[model samples]
Target: MVTWLGAPSVAALREALHEVAPQLGGGAIVPRNLVPDAAPEWSAATAVLAGRYVVKFAWAEPAALRIRHQVRVLGALKVSAPWLALPAVVVASESPALLVTELAAAVPFFDVRHLVGAGGRARVAQDLGAVLARLHDPDVLAAVSAAAGPLAAPVMPAATDALRRGPAAPAPDARWERVAAWCDWTDRVLGPAPGRSGLVHGDFHGGNHLWDERSLRLELVVDWETAGPAEPEYDLRCLPGDCGMELFGAVVDAYERVSGAALDRDRIMGWHVRTVLDDVLWRVEAGVPMPDRRTAGEWVDDLGARLAGFGVGG
Candidate 1:
């Protein structure tokens, strides 16, 4: 659902069409591969049929639960956020573990280059802030949770433990120690959940949204498989890094303005650190090439410095 690369083999495509085509209703549903070149190994192949419908199958058997949950999330969002353009489900199945949806023609927000310019960046930031505000509205969050049920809880401390104990990286580094320290900081600072929570798009980075560059509007918020109830700022961590501090501030200001809630910089920073730690541990365990190790270390170091400046960390 985020994005994908690579192509399915002839035999694989045939099997998928045979299994999925029938359930999608009557039409000439010719399948076209949609994965981009240079996709990550874990990326799944997506097929667009008849240029109007999209068929996304899980790359592995383990993804079935998330795919099914995405169907429910989209269904709920359709009713809850009518103005937002989202893919409507045509058919969903467990055996092939595929979800068919109406095709949406738009560029992923991450791919849009307009944000490099000052004026365009500010506009996009404000627009995105407003959209996030709408999605995180208390009533909307309640409705989405009621429809989709509780989502998986944050895998923070467990991920920290894994990083410390996992065989691939058994030797704990200073960065790992910082991660553990931050986890403790988070616990102390956000003790017993201060009652400010809402729907969180667990993997809500820019890559998960589609944007219309021309209109400067959000076309869709895709990849709802990770969505669930959590702290309101959980989704803020998704903002792309290309945006300068000025633009980032504009986004937070707009978000607070639209949502009528003050943004918590400390909590947001904590969540961001937790996510980075979790990702590093997952990659180490999975044997995937770790991404920008030095950059990640620098980021955490800077985060610790920031927290220390604010008297949240020693």
Candidate 2:
């Protein structure tokens, strides 16, 4: 009985969680944390249950694409052996677009961009890697494709059409400098396109992964809404590419190990840098502001640096 509505309003969480976990009593339902740092993408508020569960929801686009992607991913898991130690979906209401998945007795992995730490990091890396590998298996891919192939929200009609023309719009930046300033390894690494065959998680990174709470082990890699068929290297492009190399390295290494197939080293490399510019560009377009409206200059510099690194002097 919660009718979910706009995020950012404190009352929303109260009313929503009360609806989800009525037993806790209305007064006890309170969000543990609120993050205003995240812009148009998402804003979150968490409410911890009495030694039982944690309830959270995005004030951005909750019951829409989130539900769709989750449902789609869950549907795939039915046929695929992901062996994901994920929380069970307790009760999901499609009308208000609220999903009350069991909170893992776990914490979000803590690695730099990952959700885990040193010891926890390795375990999560291995476990998540294993799950992803199975999810990518040929049979699973085929089955998933048939069940629900790469899907973007029906609202974003051009998502698929845009990919064929080349990833949506290279990270919101015009210069693409984020990658260039990072390192020499980037240019040599991001070469030609890798073969595109399997389904991609699309937005693969730490902000979304969580460790299982009960055993303190990493659970299923949640947040699969932006999934779809695309070049295999597509997911790797989202990393921050500054000093987060070690984190990204762990993810890629673990992933290749479980998949039993060498990821195109070059392609993954390109993703490292490309995503930076792409993100910047997206932010500008989405009306997210840079501290001083200097995004244009920033982008040009970023691109220049990248070209210089790649030896593309022009």
Q: Each candidate's root-mean-square deviation in Å?
A: 5.8, 7.1
Model 1 weakest 10-residue run by lDDT: 1-10
lDDT of 2 by residue, 1-314 (tens): 22334765557765665665565435444466576556544554556545455554656654344654666666666566446544576655544445556566444544333334566656645665566555556666677767766554222122212222322434433333333343344445644444646666766665566655545455556666576666666665543243144555676688888777777645665555455444454555566665336664475465455445544453
What is the TM-score of each predicted model, taking all chains together?
Answer: 0.73, 0.61
C-alpha-based local distance difference test score of model 2: 0.54
Relative to the unseen true structure, what is the C-alpha lDDT of residue 12 in candidate 2, on a scale of 0 to 100? 72
**Clashes in model 1: which pairs?**
none
What are the per-model numbers of colliding residue pairs? Answer: 0, 27
Q: What would the per-residue lDDT of candidate 1 be over residues 1-314, giving only the tens digit for each residue?
A: 32211144434544565666654444444545434342343334566666687776654433456676677778888888776656667776655556777787777876774454766766777777888787778888778777767666433424434534433644234555656567777655555564576776677776677888777677887777677777777777545243434566678888988888897866665566566556656555655554445444565565566556546654
Candidate 1 Cα deviation (angstroms), residue 295: 6.7
